[model samples]
Target: MTTADDFRALHERPEPFLLPNPWDAGTARLLAHLGFPALATTSLGVANVVGRTRATRAEILANVREIAEATPLPVNADLENGFADDPAEAAQMIAEAADAGAVGASIEDHTGDRATPIYEFGLAVDRVRAAVETARQRSVVLTARCENLWLGVNDLSDTIKRLQAFEEAGADVLYAPGLRTLEEIRAVVSSVGKPVNVVMGFADPSITLEQLAEAGVRRISIGAALSRLALKSFVDGAREMLAGRFGFVGELPPITELQQAFD
Candidate 1:
C-alpha cells in the first residue's frame, strides 16, 4: 500500500494510535525503530533547534524532507499556517511537502500576529478548502486545525464550528491542538463526523490511551512534548557540567542501544 493509504488507514482503526513528533532525521528514525506506525514533524521543535522563533519555509521543508527520507513510517508534515496568508500560497506548501515524501500534512488557522491570533472565519475556511483540493490531488491526508484552544482562547463553541466547516471543506482529519480536557475533546468529536486528533501534551497526563479512544479520538499526537523533554535533559546536564560536577557522566548508558537504532 502507498504511504498515504497506510496513514489514512491508521486513523480508521478501532483504537487510537500515538503519533510522535520528531524534529530531525535522527529522531525520526529512532522513533520508527521504537515501533511507531507514523511520525509527525514538530514546527516549534525545529525552531528551537534552529535558534529562531519560527524557522523559514526553506528550513522547514528541508527538515521535512530529511525526516521523510529517514524512515519507512508515514510522515505528517506540520506546515504551520502553510507559511503564508494567501490561500493559494498556503496550499502550495502542501504540494511541496508531498514532494518531500510526506503522506499527510496539517494547516492551522493561526495568524502569526499576536494581536489577531486567528485568521478571520471566511478566510480561514477558504484556505482550508484550497489546501484540501491540493491534498486530494497529492493523495495526502489533510488535517485542518482550529487554533483557538491552542492559542489559549478557551472557546469550544468556536473550535467546533471551525472544525465542522473544515470537515465540510474535505479535511480528512480535524485537529485542535490546545484542548485541555476530555470534556472539550468529546464536544469536538461529537460535533464532527471525521476522525478527531488530540494533542496529548495539551490534555491531562492522567488520561489514558483507552480513555481517549473511548471518547472518540482516533489519533493522538504529542506535539513537541518529547522533544521538550529531551531538551530539558540536555539543559539539566549542561548545568551540572557548568557547576564543575562530573557525576552526570556516570549516569550514561552504553551507546550500543542508540547505535543499534541508527543501524
Candidate 2:
C-alpha cells in the first residue's frame, strides 16, 4: 500500500490503533522504534519544546518535516485551526503540510478566543470542506476536530452535529476531544459513520483500551501527555539535584540505548 493508504488503513483496523503524539524528531524516532504504526505531532508538545505559547505554521511545518523524515511510519500533524482565520489560507496551509510529507493532518474548529471558543457552525463546516478538498488533492488523510467539548460547550448533541457536518464535508476521521463517557464517545462515533479518533490521557485513567474500542473508537492519541510526562521527570530530577541528591541520575536510559535508537 502507498504511504497515504497505509496511514488510512490504521484507522480501519478492527481494534483501535494507538497513534502516539511525538514533539520532535527524537521522540518520533523513539516511538517508531517502540513499534507504533503511526505518529501524530502534538501541538502542545511542540509548543513546549519551542517555548512558544503556540507554534506558528512555519515552526509546525519544520517539525512535521523532521519527524516524517526521521521515521518510516506515517506522521499526522496537529495543524491547529489550520493556522488562519480565512478558509482559503487554511486550505493552502493544509496543502503545504501535505507537501512537507505529512500523510495525515488535523484541522480543529477552535477560534482561539475563550469568550468565543469555537467557530460558528457554518464557517466551521466550510473550513473543514476547504481543508478536505485540499487534502484530497494530495491524497492526505484529513481529520476534522470539533472543539466544542474542550471549549466548555459541554453539549454532546451539538458536538455530534458538528462531527456529522465535518464527515459530510469530506473529513476522513472525526475527533471530539474531552469526551469523558463511553456513551458520549459511542454517540459521536455512531453519528459520524467515519473513523473516530479519541484523545486519551486527559480522560479517566480507569478507562481501558477495550472500553474505548467497544465504544467504536477507531484510533487513539495521547496529545502532549507523553511530553508532559517527560518534562515531569526532568523537573523532578532537577529538584532532587538542587537538594543535593544524585539518585535521579540513575533513572535515565543509557546513552548507548538512545544512540542506537537514533541510529
Candidate 3:
C-alpha cells in the first residue's frame, strides 16, 4: 500500500494513535527508532530548523523532505494555513507537501493577521474544499483544523459549526486544537462524522490516551510538544554549563543506548 493509504488506515482503529512531531531528520530517525508508527512536521519546530520565527515555503518543504526521507514511517506535514490566504495557494501547498513525501497534512483556519486571526467562515470552508480537491488527487489524508478554540476564541458552538462544514467539504479528519476538558473534546467528536484528531499538547497532562479515545478521539497528535520539551532540556543543560556543573549529564540516556536506538 502507499504511504498515504497506510496513514489513512491508522485512523480506523478504536484507540487513538499518537502522531508525534519531529523537528528534523535526526528527530525523525529517533522517533522511528523509538517505535512510533508515524511522524509529522511541526511548523514551529521547522522554524527552529532555520532559526527563524516562521519558515518560508521552500524551508518548510525542505524540512518535510528531510524528515520523510529519514524513516520509512509516514510523515504528516503541518502546512499551517496552507501558507497563504487564498484557497488556491492552500491547494498548491498540499500538492507540494505530497511531492515532498508527506502522506498526510493539515490546513488550519488561522489567518496571519492578528487583527483578524481567523478567516471568515465562508472563505475558511472554501479553502478547505480547495485543499480537499488536491488531497483527493494525491490520496493525502487532510485534517481540517479550526483555530478558534486554540486561538482564545472560547466559542465551542462556532468551532463545531466550522468543523462540521469542513467535514462536509470532504476533509478526512477534523480537529479543534485547544479543547481543555473531556466534555469539550467529546462534544467536538460527537458533532462530526469524520475522524477527529486531538492535540494532547494543549490538554492537561493528567488526561490519558485512553480517556481521549473514550471521549471518541481517533488520532492524537503532539504538536510542537516534543520540540518544546527538547528545548527545555537544552536550556536546562545550558544553565548547568553556566553554573560549572556536569549534573545534568546523568539525566540523559547512555551514549550506547542512544547509539543502539539510532542504529
- C-alpha lDDT of residue 238 in model 1: 97
lDDT of 3: 0.90
| lDDT, ranked from best to worst | 1, 3, 2
Instruction: Tell me the number of clashing residue pairs for each predicted model.
Output: 0, 0, 0
Candidate with the greatest lDDT versus the true structure: 1
> Which model, 1 or 3, shows the larger lDDT?
1
Q: Candidate 1 residues 12-84, lDDT tens each?
A: 9999999999999889988998899999998888988977768888888988899999999999999999989
Cα lDDT for residue 131, model 3?
A: 96
Q: Residue 4, candidate 2: how far off, in angstroms?
A: 0.7
- What TM-score do all the candidates reach, one by one? 0.98, 0.97, 0.97
Ranking by TM-score: 1, 3, 2
Cand. 2 TM to true fold: 0.97
Per-residue alpha-carbon lDDT of model 2 for 150-173, expressed as tens digits?
Answer: 778899899999999999999999
- C-alpha lDDT (0 to 100) for residue 222 of candidate 1: 97
After superposing candidate 3 on the true structure, give the runs of residues whose Cα lies further than 4 Å from its correct spot: none
Off by over 4 Å in 2: none
